[model samples]
Target: MGFSTEFNSICKFKSARELEDLFEYGKTKMRKSGFRIYPTGMKVIAFDPENRAVAIVQIKASIAEIDFQDREITLVEMDLVRPLTPEESAVETALAYEMFFRDHESN
Candidate 1:
């Protein structure tokens, strides 16, 4: 018998527009200080229950120029994922996880 595993991906977005597009469906916050919180656009990796995969991003893209309006890059790996439920999506990365509800009134 096998267990259904929890899949995870860590993405890093390089520009503002790219970040904006990634978080379109997510709750966005714009501060008066001009900072934002968006999804990280990183390559995906798959790991089974044993967690034996190399800690390396298998595929990568090198953009000569990152012009938001005139760029096309295919994301190498993407499995259909349902939009994150509010509770599920609320989980944050270790770096910023502490502020999850600190500024919720505005968002």
Candidate 2:
């Protein structure tokens, strides 16, 4: 199965190079996980490996306009809030574990 989520705001990175740099920064800050680009190539999600935090970015069509341009990376507009608390992570982890086991059992 696949996962889906709804975002209220969009972030426009100047170019793919800029997006890559942002992913690298997230990897270093989280220390355990990196970023994930969706198959559609329109969204990117970064999260802490331990489930402590998550940041999702939806690329705007304007990206295509600058796809070949070189420019500095910037988080044009972001609405994602702070990282999750330990308790929140715990609950999410539990639910994820349950789903994994249940899915595997049926298989």
Candidate 3:
């Protein structure tokens, strides 16, 4: 099947305050920094104790395929990075995906 040209939404677990601010302006920032490694960027569907708020991220079409298909090869924070296990990293996104769908279905 053909794929979507851009991401419509991303699931993130935000602090109540963070969520409030996002909705306040109807806009949010998704930088390539502070999370998984994306040579360009990634839209996370994350809901661990740390992630925050639902976001709609638009990945550039040039990199979307890899961003969508690749896993973190390194954990990133600011300019610092550390190695990661691909299989291990999947859990958070997997869990987040489940939560996203569950929430969607209930609505």
Candidate 4:
């Protein structure tokens, strides 16, 4: 039997390099912010500090053996099931811009 999950994918990358590029771009653009991951073995959600953009990844919990507490899981072994939606992207962008300006203003 197969289980079903619901999530939205705004874009899909064919390779790890592409995903890495996107992550790098966000890091450089956002500046002083980083991504956080919440893994529950079956599902993983990654987002920025401001919680503007989020990426949800679903894994085959039945077949995969994962140690939830072990934070060393390899991304290559897991699958990227979904991406941020248009609205999520917009929110993230806006938050990032706000944070950037706020940081500079405080200096």
Question: Which one is best on lDDT?
Answer: 4
* Runs off by more than 4 Å, candidate 4: 1-42, 45-54, 59-76, 92-107
Off by over 4 Å in 1: 1-8, 23-82, 92-107
Clashes of each: 7, 0, 5, 0
The candidate that achieves the highest TM-score relative to the unseen native structure? 2
Q: Can you rank all candidates by lDDT, best first? A: 4, 3, 2, 1
Compared with the true structure, what per-residue lDDT tens digits does model 1 show for residues 12-77?
A: 323354334334533221211112222234444322122222122322332222236544322332
Rank order (by TM-score, best first): 2, 4, 3, 1
Stretches of model 3 off by over 4 angstroms after superposition: 1-9, 29-34, 38-107
The digit string of per-residue lDDT tens for model 4 on 41-84 reads: 45444444443345644433222223466332223223445667
Give, for candidate 1, the lowest lDDT window spanning 10 residues: 29-38
Q: Which pairs clash (backbone N, Cα, C closer than 3 Å) in model 1?
A: 11-40, 11-41, 11-42, 12-40, 12-41, 12-42, 13-41
| Candidate 2 Cα errors over 4 Å, as ranges | 1-47, 50-79, 101-107
Relative to the unseen true structure, what is the C-alpha lDDT of residue 38 in candidate 1, on a scale of 0 to 100? Answer: 20
lDDT of candidate 3 over 1-107, digit per residue (tens): 23232232343333454344444654333322122423235443323224432333322222222344453222221111221245534654556447554565432
Question: Distance (Å) between predicted and true CA of 93, model 2?
Answer: 0.7
Q: Give lDDT tens digits, candidate 2, residues 63-93.
A: 1112234432222322233344667656654
True-vs-predicted CA distance for residue 45, candidate 4, Å: 4.1
